[model samples]
Target chain A: MTTTPAADTAVTAAALALGDDALVLSHRLGEWAGHAPVLEEEVALANIALDLLGQARVLLSMAGDEDELAFLREERAFRNLQLVEQPNGDFAHTIARQLYFSVYQHLLHDRLASGDGPFAPLAGKAVKEAAYHRDHAEQWTLRLGDGTDESHARMQAAVDALWRYTGEMFQPVEGIDGVDWPGLESTWRDIVEDVLGRATLTLPEGPRTGAWRAGAGRQGLHTEPFGRMLAEMQHLHRSHPGATW
Target chain B: MVTTTPLEEQLLELAGSVPDPELPVLTLRELGVVRAVRAHGTDSVEVDLTPTYTGCPAVEVMSLDIERVLREHGVREVTVRRVLAPAWSTDDITDEGRRKLREFGIAPPRTGAASGPVRVALGPTRTREGGPADEPEPVRCPHCGSPETELLSRFSSTACKALRRCLACREPFDHFKEL
Candidate 1:
């Protein structure tokens, strides 16, 4: 009853792509639980992660069992961007990653929400939460980038280091609402530039295009870090297969 | 404002009054997220509820709680469905809900004007006093009933709150964010 055959398949593919993005990033943020720099940030990051997890639950459940989709999927089956699966290098790196992903998520959700597509209800709902996620990232980016010398250096390094992975987010996913990716990219660039400039940081010079630009996570391919991360994420659910809490 | 049959009225009096899992102070009815509670065929009842936020984790729990509560009261069949067409808004929180939220130590949703940071279906993100010149004043502290409070952070312990510290009471309170 959820859909016709063709629509279901298309929706499933689109959901998995977007859902994996949120699920993987949620797990990555969950990794910060006991390790974030401060107690407040521990709560804040967890809030954002939980929000993503909730979105992931709805999106993944649209295709199949959320628990199975999240816990049982092999690393290569994941369609998340390589950027999200990257390790939390440091607090600054984490914030930088959040900044990139949340803005894209916000804009993407906004576009989807404006349409009558199947993803609209969820996306319309999700974009608001993504706004907060972006705000959280922006707040810290500004504070860290313009703060003490150590903080500024770390923030700058994090931004520059993660620039390459961002390109994968813009790759067209089949069945997602037809969005103007070129326009989205430009908007993202403008927003990031404004925020980073105000924070006294420069735009990352790393390649985001051409043959050398890092990407390809969309085709169920991922980097080395993802394998390890996925293993850890799946361990608990795998430990007691078929057990329910 | 709710129009229902006598049987539905009986069901709603119980089913609609379920407290929100996150706020706990406001009922689903008072919060206005309970869209409907009526008969769903011969011997079954259905409750329609929407989440405060699309991603609020409490929505599922709230649904489960509603089912549990109704079944415990001898309702043979119950179904909880979530709808998204007419999306939920902070404006839907009733005045009674706001009063209850204050008693529960969380500042209620802003009464009028978009002063708090809330997102909706359309338009650019217009944040509070930062841009909107006609936006209302800051939410008052719930503790001392004072107008003097400093916002500690827009993101708080929960998605629907902003952390505010009262200048009068020196107490950190949760302001139910507009959204």
Candidate 2:
């Protein structure tokens, strides 16, 4: 198609926002490499991480150099959702994060895939992979939420703790054309509520709206844990600049 | 439409003949990743390769292998461009590729399933066929050809396959999951 400088800048901003989300979450999931509770779970998490990493590479490349965008960017420059940068506290917490983010991502990509835009091609491909990731989270949520007193308690607590971060996901991102943000948000709530109901867990009563919502990653603002995570992530690349296998 | 020259056709064949880095049993042609090959003046060529999964690590190796193979076949330069529009699907795998996958102890993905967003069905894996519009035929075990197979894990050793075990033979095998 045709584009002006303003449209190109908007596309770049949107690409960086989406790309940073994938890159940050991929690294967080990759941290579970040797620490997963089981072998199968470890493989599954890594596989999902790889998928996100692949998406990150494509999206970041659309904005600028993928490696530089990922490794050299300061903490205040990242545009990822704060929810994705949250540490993997426990198995239950990680699954909760996956459930919220994948549902939003899958739905968003599904909409983007149906559009004629810069992100449509990658969205068309990633939507399928996101379906699997969403399924994985949903299955785990059901098992843990309905399993036993302790598992159910942990799952409930995890979802509630992360509830505040849910609101930021529905915020409209620039250059992502042709999406019904409010409709998507309502649908997200319905899906999450159904899953939680089936899992025998109560929906978090935390405020997900209003001015106090936990977000601002899109504006290069992040939570306390993000700086440490970025330091650890960029160390290797910075130490050995221009290194290759 | 531009008709491919004989040299382009031959170069396409050479590029497509490269074996997949992950599944050596299938060539890139059989896998349906090598979309097309174009020749620019006899010495320079470009090949189109689509990834099975967005993050499939094999794509890099496949590109390198294709370049090496085409270059050795008398082309001075080779360029492999990754195409993502009309995203690659399991349905793209050739019938021969499916048969070879089954022969190699991996159940092939069911064809004819509509490509798009799929609902998450969480529960015990059943062996029912024609159950619903979304659910296609049951994945039969490649070893014993038993239909009583259950999904163990959605993500297996690779992104494109799922780990499943046959209830009859108690053998676990990877099934190329539908994208």
Candidate 3:
């Protein structure tokens, strides 16, 4: 089957977008290695981070190779959605971010698995893992949401703060042309609503089409925060090119 | 006819005996990681293994172990390959291996279930009481004969198992998911 040049470019961009999301989030989650709220949760978050990193490695490697895709790409060339690139605010905010992104990822992966594209198989493999990520986030969300008043308040504030970023998850980028956008959007709405119901959190309703606080991360245009993130992520690799541990 | 060289037989025996580094009771044969073994034209032996989990640290140790065992059997040049497709599952754990894991104090995962099938079902099976849709069959705690177990953590020592503590025996055991 011959893919038109446009289609090929689009597919490549879509894969990069997906891969970048996993890579950035995996790196962010890795920061919680020994800094989690509890011991059991530290292990759990680490495991989840590793899983995301594993997925990122495969997806990024598939996008190109290990070195080229990871080390070679410039900050402006990245296409991950902004939500993933957002700083892990606090314990409550991190869990809140996990809940939002994992829910989106689970739904996105589930739908993409059935799509008629090269990404289908990758999505199929990743969806199972992402499902667990969503479960982990959901469990934490419930515990935090239903726990003490302080915990509930913190979690609620987190959810509210992160809600603005959720819009971009469903927004279709130019590179992902020919995707089943309607179906994906519907699935995202349904899953997000269900999870929000369980967490006893209200969905923040607003004008869906409004100026984003953070500009486009999907268009290879990222916030200044991404530049700082890249500096730290690439420091060692750039310093010692072709060096291996 | 001279019996097949003791070297060949010994290598085969060593290959057969090397247990999976993750699930130590299960031989790589039972785990289905050992794909093939062949004498590499004379002085060398080639062995292939697939990783049970992506980026599993144990795969490196298992590869080294294979080389050590084969060297002991007077063979050199062991090759281990990481095959990604047809991913490993708890279902691959043989019945005999399951028994061995139980004896070793680490509970073998239940055959056929993925990491947390019951918990995965919890969302769709949400009722007034928050039970599963179709009541999940009792998961026997491999530590004791008790069905009174609670899921303590989903992430265990490995991704394949969940940490469950038995209420009856007060022991934490790995419930191999019924893959």
Tell me which residue pairs clash in candidate 2.
none
Tens digit per residue, CA lDDT, model 3, A1-245: 78698877777777788889988897888778778887777777777777777667766766678677777789988888878887877898998889888877877766666665666755655666777778878888888887888988888898888777777777675555455666776776677677667777766676432474443778777766778888888888898998887
Task: Estimate the TM-score for candidate 1.
Answer: 0.91
- TM-score each candidate: 0.91, 0.97, 0.81
lDDT of 2 at A157: 92
Model 1 pairs whose backbones collide = none
Listed models, DockQ each:
0.39, 0.79, 0.26
Ranking by lDDT: 2, 1, 3
What is the descending TM-score order? Answer: 2, 1, 3
RMSD of 1: 3.6
Kindly list the per-residue Cα lDDT of model 1 for residues A141-214, writing each as its tens digit: 98999999999999999999899888877778877767998899899999999999999999998577435444
Off by over 4 Å in 2: A209-215, B114-117, B122-124, B128-135
TM-score of 3: 0.81
lDDT of 1 by residue, B45-121 (tens): 89888887767878888888888888887788999888775567778888898889899888786755332433422
Clash pairs for candidate 3: B109-B175, B109-B176, B110-B176, B111-B178, B112-B178, B112-B179, B113-B178, B113-B179
Residue A176 lDDT, candidate 2, scale 0-100: 87
lDDT of 2: 0.91
For all candidates, what are the clash counts? 0, 0, 8
